[model samples]
Every structure is written in structure tokens, then in C-alpha cells.
Target: MEQQQIKLVVLDMAGTTVADQHEVEACFAKAARMSGLEASDEAILAAQGLSKRYVFQLFWRAQLGESHPDVETQVDKSYAIFKEVLEAHYQTQPVFPTDGCLKLFSYLKQNNIKIALTTGFYRVVTDIILGRLGWLEGLDENRIGNDDSIIQASIASDEVEHGRPAPLMIQKAMRLLGVTDPKHVINAGDTPSDLQSGNAAGVLLNLGVTNGTHTVEQLIGHPHDALIGSIDEIINLIEGIKQGRPSGKTADAYSF
Candidate 1:
């Protein structure tokens, strides 16, 4: 197989690129409780990279049978509350970039590789975080690509037809970045859904970062090129991928 040069890199937001102190879980828990659902942290953690609306629907359907008339309404109600709580948490909280994330972003920019942020967050919440960080400058109204901007693209879960575990976000990013071949893309995140989407899209490499919401044990057995540490570890992996080196996996460390 011919190795295609990488053109775009798609990354998850909260736990992957942004420092998450389980604030998302705390907000989600508050919303779940107010809506009469006693969801555990493990459950919420497991659904880390999924759409919040979808997560509510899943839990509601699990509690109330799928055919029950109250499922959709409860999902809507729960999601509305989640958005309120989530928005407030992010608004008041200290939001910062994850370790080595800025350096990696600069590396990609200097190499002429497009950087896109895809998050399970809806657009409003996504903007709150980006606006605070001043990372929203280059995105168009639709959050599409702009080469002159620090980030070439910003994709919110609500912007796509489907969220993680589905390839739509990654595919949409590729389209906006003008990257037709998945072989020319790289996808990285801290959750299994992130890996699945990248694998589903047939990207050049799908990576997992343990320093996020999940641990190495939690991320193992997923179809990923390797499980790494910080976001910046990707710099070496990108070089290896571009040079036709298939970075292999190892235990507990950055195997890529």
C-alpha cells in the first residue's frame, strides 16, 4: 500500500485536548439526578465521547423501556438540564489546554497539516470553551475550515447527523479540510468511540491518550494504532506514519 502524506488531524476536545477534571461528569451527574436518574460515574465515563443527547436517550431508554412514551420527552428534558449545568460549569470553571496540546497544535501548523477539533459537546458549549481560550477565530459560521486560523476547523456533535462511534464527524472534518482520502488523516482521542470512528473512517492511524478520561486498561483491546500519554506524543507518531513506519503497540506507554 502506498503511504499517503497526512493532511488533516482530528482530535476530541474535553479530555483529549482540554484538561478535564471530571467537571463534565459532575455536571452530567447533577442533570441526571434532577431528572430522576441515578447514573454512576462509571456509566458516564464509559459514554465519554458520545453525544450528550444520545447518552440521555440511552439512559432513559434503559430506565424506561424504549417503547415507553416518556423516553423521548425525558431525554429532551434531561439534555436541556445537562446543557444548562454544563454551560454554567464551563463558564465558571478554569478551562485550559491539556498537557503538550499547544505544542502539538503548533507542530501541526508548522508542518502545514490542518488541525480540527471534534467534540461530543454541542455548538453552544463548544463555543463557550473555545471563546474562552480564544481558539474560535478561524472557524466560519458553520465552524468549517479556515487556513489562516490557529485551528482549521471546529466540529460539534450537534453539527453532524451522528456523533462518535459513528464516522460522520471525522468524515465531515475531512470534507471541510479537503482531505478526500482517509489514508491522509490522523484521529486521536481519549475514548473508545474516538478510536472506533477513526477506524470506521479508515484513517491513517487511530490513537488513544491515557492522560485523559480513560486509563490504558480502559482503552486496551480497541482498534487503535497505539495508546499514548500526552497529546504531544503524537508528534513522533505523525513523523513515523508519514515515513511509512507502522508504529506498533506496547504496554502502559506510548507504543506509537
Candidate 2:
């Protein structure tokens, strides 16, 4: 199949752009242990692409049962512990950008392709993470009045009615970026839901990166236009796709 032309690129934060899964998991485990609750990595991993509030609710429901009394109180206490741990550790062990991310952003910007960001994280948490990573430091001061300006625009879960597997956030990002045709936008993420969102949005290109939580084999079952192990591989794939050159086989052809 011929590659569809891409005009805008939408990126998912957390696992997709930042490399801090281990840190996040450790923080959650510590919080769970402190609360006298057992948290397994598998359970945490399953909630990878969900909002913080939703994640908290999932853990609460899992540990305290579906109809536990004072569920809100317990959830609040657990979340407080989680926040404390995250704040203390996130600053010291911030998430690092994936390899070639800066280069890819620069290349796309130079090529006049609009870049947008969408995340399951709330705006406040997003702000905190970006501040901790110093991601805005490399941008031009004139262009970015504040840290938020580092991105052309963003669609946070807090603003969207439906989260991942809904495509509302992706659609919102495309609209904010003035990308009319879904076929002209490329959605890149690390989860099956991410691919589903893009596919549901009718995006022309859906690129899955194995650098995040999901493996190549997991993404293969989804409708991704291409699959790569790292962000660096994206540039080459995009170039090939643009020139009508075959990049490689589907995700099914590659083992995790």
C-alpha cells in the first residue's frame, strides 16, 4: 500500500516521549506498600495509558474491592502518598526524552509539519514533568512565552470527554493544529489504545514505537501504519514512506 501524505505529527507523552516507566512503577509500588496494599507490576503496567485519577481508582477498586466503604478516602490517602513519592523522586530522576526525539522534532518543524502533543496526564502533572525535565530550556524564548508554548498545542485528558480508545484527544489536537484531514496527520504512541485512537480518527499514519510499555508483538494486532523500536527509526521510516519506498514489514513480522 502507498503511504499517505503526512502534514502534522501528534505525540503521546509519558511512555511515548519520556523514558521513566521503571521510576513510575517503583513510586507506585512504594506507595502501595506504605498503604498496606500489594501492587503488582502487571496491574500497574495495565494502567499505563490511563489518567492519574483513573489509575488511582483502578488500584483502589482492586485492593479494597468494588464496593469498599470510604473508597474515596482511601483513594485520596493513597494518592497523597503516591504524589509525595512522585514529587520527591521525579525531580531527582526525571524522565529523559527518547533517542532522536529532539532531532525528529527539529526535522518535522523544519519541514513545516505541525507538531502537537496529547496525553492522558492532567495539565498540572504534565507541567510538573516538563518543568522537571527542563524540556523547554532548548526552545527559543521568543517563540515560547512559557513552558506550555514549547508545544504548538496540547490535548489533555482533563479536557477531553473520552480518553484513549476514543480518539477525541487526537481529533482535538488535529483541529487545534488546523489539520483538517485525518489522512494528513500522523499519530505516534507506545500503546495499543494509542493506535486505536489514531485509527478511529482515520489518521493517515499510525506509528507505534516499542520504546514504551507495549511490545512490537502487542502493537501488531492493532492498525498501525508502521512500527519501530525507537524514535530515531521514525525519521527514516517517514522518509521512506514519503518517497513511496517500502520501509519494512508489519508489526507481526517483528518479534518484540
Candidate 3:
């Protein structure tokens, strides 16, 4: 069998690789209730793809009149509570990798393609989740080893100059991976912001998966090169692209 010529694969965490949406929402609700605020589901959904600190700031500003009273302190408290909730649930029901995740990752690794993990999660929370999943082994120092076939160049929403709608993270990932041409890379995620980031980064492919909070229709309107139901579909699309098959229209070519 001929090897595919995929250079890099950038994956988003949270809903894309792990199914922690329910847990994340529960934690946010618990934190909001502790602060004597009632956070609506719509509010929580809108806060998706933002850092926990930013989410807390949004809630604090809405509930407490302003982001005053020390926004960092409030963020710290909310995150602490969120971690407690995560630990309680994770202790009994640990988060497992999404279906076909292991197999797909193994396949990509075997093919010697570079893998980059990008997420809106903070380093603290990301560390905990990766540790639980045994992904920490790859994080020795700032650069994860490619010998394991999985590399993470995640830019936390807080760490970057701008999150999502901006392409700094993806650009940094490409630079680190030595991929100069955007056409040699594929960015996969479950949100419109993910597609936007990939598009802004000038990546060759911006793939959106419906496994996240967004519906297929919602993603269709976004600037994604292709929309699929899951990451497994992304793998199939990559195979098709490698085989000289048409992968459908560019995001801009689609009409709503």
C-alpha cells in the first residue's frame, strides 16, 4: 500500500477528541450556583470555545454589574470549584477517548504524520485531563516527542493574544511543525471558531465535525472546507483527498 502524504493534523480537544461537554457544563452550573448566580444553558453554550477564566469573567460581569471585585480572584474560585466537580465525577466515571480516537491516532502515527493538539482549555485543566488519559507522557518539556506519533502544541485561550476567531495558535503550531504551506495541513474541530481559526491560519483544509455543541447546519454556514459527523469521517476524507478524489467545495463556495 502506498503511504499517504499528509504532513500535519491539528486537532481540537474538548468535544473534538473527548466527550466532556456534559461534565464541563455541569461544572459551570455548579460554579455559578455557588456564586449565587443562575447561569442559563444558552449562556453556557455561547461561552463554548472560551477559556474558563473568560467564561467566569462573562458571568461575573453579567451578574455582578462589572468585572470588578477582582476578576482574577473570581476566576480562580470558579476554576477551583470546577476542578472539584471534575475530580468527583472523573474519579468514578473517568473520561474516555471518543470512539475510533485511539485507532485513528494510531493510524496517523504509523503513517508518520505530525499531530498538533489545540484547545481553548487552560494549561491547568488541560494538564489534568491529559494526565488522566496518559497523554502527559508526551509533554516532557514544552515540545512533545514525535516518536510517540502524537504531539500537542496547544495554545490556551488565556495564553494566546486572541483565541479562536484569531489564527495565532494555529500559525504557531504550523511554525513549530515546520509546515510552511497551509495546503499541507488539516485542522479539525467541532466548532465554528475552530474552522475560523484554520481558515485564518491559511491551512489547506478546515474540517468541522458535528460532535461538538454546534449542529451540522450551524457549521455549514461557517468557513469550513468540509463538514463531517465525526473525526472518523475526517480520516476518511483525508484518505479520499490523498487518492485524488474531490473533497467537495471550499467553505466560501457553499451557499446557505
Candidate 4:
């Protein structure tokens, strides 16, 4: 029997494929305060990988009743501020790929593995970040890229009915990329939510990166196939899968 081969790699944007220097947190902190809600850095950090709008709503609903009269108002106001701040930050600040990001892309290209980026960000900011990185170069008006392009496709949280921890984005990505089997896809991100979504999708490998928003200690106890040290380490794991043997020499390659 022929061994199953990976055909798609779905990656998260902020902190996973893109270098984040607390820029997102700065924006979120501003929005959190602007909404007249108090959220600590720890709270905000824990909310990473979730839809931005959902995060605000979550915080607001937590503070107030789910049906509070002011919930929608606060969500709207603070999200607007977040958009302004985030757009300004990305427009003025430089954006770059994370460590080994290009290397992984090149490897996937060489092997014909489709790449899709899923984000907690909405479409406007997602386009901003992707455009800044020139990853949106060849995509059509539909925002569908391809392996021949920098990326194949991108799914923003707002595009789907549900976001991370729901598998909607991953399922949408698989549908968009023409992939049928979760056993042939690898989902990777920098947050526990990423793992949960991948698990929900039942992908071949649900992976996490420690070099991003979450540390090894933070990601432990999360259901995942592996929690690697960096994005580059995935090359090793994939190679092992291809070779039918895993040396597993890289520390933390599959820890929790």
C-alpha cells in the first residue's frame, strides 16, 4: 500500500508565521481599555488565537451579562478602536516573516504541499498583514492564493460562522484547497486554541510552536500531536514521516 502523504499545511498568522513583537497585544490592550473594561496582560495573552471581535465580546460578556444593553455598543466601539490602532501600526511598522518561515514555505513548495493561513484577525487586518509581507501578491479578488503563490489561501475568523476551537476555518481551508482527508493535512499555530481546532478537525498532525505567543509550559496539557521548539522543526518531523522513521533528535519535537 502506498503511504499517505501530506498535501496541505494550514498555519496561523500572528506569532506563528509572522513575527510579533507585542504589537497585537498593544492594540488589544488599547482596545480593552478603550472599551472601559480592565483586562490584564495575562488575560489578554490567554485570549490569543481567538477572533479579535470574539475576544472583545468575551471580555465584555464576562464583565456584564450576555444580554447587557451595553454589550454590543462596547463591542462595536472598542473593536473600531482596535481596527484603527492595528491598521495604523501595521501601516507604519515593518512586517516580516517569522524565523524559518521562508524556509518552510520553500520546502512546502518543493514538495507540492498547499499552504493556507488562518488568522484570528478579521479580513481588513489580515489583508493588511499579508499585503505588507507581499503574500497577497498573486491572489485574486476572492483572496484565494495558490502554492505557486506565496500562500494558497487565507481564512479570516470573520469569514466563517465560527472561529478557532470550532474547526470551521480549517474545514473551510480544506474545502478551498481541494483537500479531502484530515489525515493528509497538518495544522500548526502558536496557541492552544490552534491545537483544539486542529483536534476538532482531526487533522493528521496538530502542532504548536513554543517560540511564538505561547511557551512550552503554557502549551502543555493542551491536546496536540506535538509542541515543537520552532516552525523549522516541522521540516524534520515531516521528513521523518516521509522516510517512515522518525529520529526525533530535535528536543521538544513531540512533547505533549
TM-score of 2: 0.81
* Candidate 4 pairs with clashing backbones: 145-152
Q: Which residue runs of candidate 2 sit more than 4 Å off their true CA positions?
A: 1-3, 137-150, 245-256
Off by over 4 Å in 1: 247-256
- What is the per-residue lDDT of model 3 for residues 75-161, given as tens digits with 9 covering 90 to 100? 678777876775566555677777666776786777677777777776666767766777767665664555563554555566678
RMSD of each: 2.0, 4.0, 3.9, 1.9
Question: For candidate 4, what is the lDDT?
Answer: 0.87
lDDT of 2 by residue, 1-256 (tens): 3346667778887777777566677777788789766668888766666665667777788878989997778778877888788767766664678766778877776667767777777665666677766654543422222223446665678788878878998888776666688877778888777888888998766788887888877778888877777765666656756666543333442444
Residue 29 displacement in candidate 3 (angstroms): 1.3
lDDT of 1: 0.87
Error of 4 at 161 (Å): 0.5
The reply for model 4, stretches above 4 Å from the true place, is 1-3, 246-252
**TM-score, predicted candidate 4 vs. hidden true structure:** 0.95
lDDT of 1 by residue, 1-256 (tens): 2555778889999999999988898899999999998688999999999999999999998999989998999999999999999999889988999999999999999999999999999999999999988899877897775767889989999998999999999999989878899988889999989989889999877888889999989888788877888889778777765566664223433443
TM-score for model 1?
Answer: 0.94
